[model samples]
Target: WNIENIIDNATLKYSVNFVEDVVNLDVSPGASGIGCTEMVISNLGTITIDVDVEVSGDNITISPGAVSVTLAPEGNITTPICALALTRSEARAHPVSVLALGRETNTHLNQVQVTSNFTAIVDPYARLSIQAPMPAKHCIGSTFWTNFTGVNNGNANDSVVFEVSNIQELEDAGFTFTLPILQYQLEPALLDPLKQNSFQNLVIKVDSENVTEGYYNMIVTIATTMDGESFSAATTYQIWMANCQEQDANIEDDSLPSISLIPTLIAIGIIAMRRRY
Candidate 1:
């Protein structure tokens, strides 16, 4: 029983060449990164394969790396095989370079091989965009509303509305607005119907003049709904004779911040400081 006659084997020589301008590897998790070169010999003809491959700067070379073979139509062939392992240190470390594969066989076995190169690139981080409205400041006798909007990166469609106020009708004698100094409401179906998130909250800033210079207070009532729950954000500010005079200052400023009290409808308001000169 000749051992060579009982086996069918083949030899495969493999080498690698890093392509030019294809370096700087950037790999992610669970990703196949640059590592080693492999050689697979299919349909072996009862033979022994001894592969000795050496890699240099961007190049791979095979030595005496051939296989000798004998074939049996139907039998088990056992042969000695050798493998070569290449590491990152074995290759040229350049930002951009190519590896070349070369083969050399001192045997009569047929040579089978292939080559390829990989590309590198930088990965980018993700970010989110948010949209919102600017706050508005208004004066007494000013019929207006303030609008606010905000988008959350964590909760894109979630937001809320809140309000505070202090209205005083007279001074020294102490007084309060006979009527609510300011009222506000949220638009865009506060708490999106589809998303079901909190509605954006708005805080109305009444011109300090909403009340008299004496002692006075103004009320700011804010209303909105979230998660089918009705919530209110309101506050009150003391108003006095100074508040009434503050309105004069607001009128003089001419550049008071204005807002669309009603959606689609724009109104004017004044922002000014009352200085006790």
Candidate 2:
């Protein structure tokens, strides 16, 4: 036999194609707490494939990391990916890597990397309280002053607005008052969590010309809006107003009898002392 024929007969050649090398994955950014992003994996191979997924990152995680997928020649599946940001302070871009492996060969066929930017948001909560004791009495045409303290109990920064309601209702019941500031801003900037701000010297004036002497109930509301959501706290105060002219007359009437009896009592004591001597 010829040497060239023997060599040609002994040699054999074949080709193998791996679909993982050319596969493409789609990923997007995720929102913290609110929701997650969806990532799609497509299989473009000649044979059915079972893909196993794994995620590597501190700020991101994959649901059902390992999946049993039977691709009919060419198929696709979508998976949910979530971001692990829990606080408002965790506002940053996070790097996440996803790897898909072939179960039979245990080979890493494809890797997809993404920079997920998550929104840092928390529930908004606040508490409102009167910083000073409510004035028991207010004179007509005089101003009543007090302080209100607001505390932010949530993790986010917020701004507070003040509202005074039931004023007209109180006026209907013979108690009239005026609030100089209908809507007062607590602070120019956002208030942080567990932080407090005071609204100093809030003036409530009794209407001298329009109000009748009586007691009235008023409601004060403190509200804050964040991310299209609203949080509010409310409190009530009782206001008592005395007519200035009537009050002066009553004082004068009560003092007149006492003033008239003092001289008579003094004379009797002098006479008693003279008799004893």
Task: Tell me, by TM-score, which candidate is best.
Answer: 2
Instruction: Write model 1 residue lDDT over 141-178, tens digit each, in one string.
Output: 44333333322222112234333333322222232222
The residue pairs that clash in candidate 2, if any, are none
> Which regions of candidate 2 fall more than 4 Å away from where they truly are?
1-38, 46-52, 56-78, 82-135, 149-160, 170-210, 224-227, 244-277
Per-residue error (Å), model 1, residue 74: 16
Tens digits of per-residue lDDT, candidate 2, 1-277, equal 1111110111111111212211112121232343355555555544445555565444544344444444444466665554443433222344445555432223323322222122212233333333334647777666555444444443334456666667668667655466666444443213333323434335565554456787766676667665554667777777777788888999988966677799999999999999999
Ten-residue stretch with the least lDDT total in model 1: 121-130
Candidate 2 TM-score over all chains jointly: 0.50
Superposition error at 133 for model 2 (Å): 5.6
User: To one decimal, what is the Cα RMSD in angstroms of model 2 from the true structure?
Assistant: 12.2
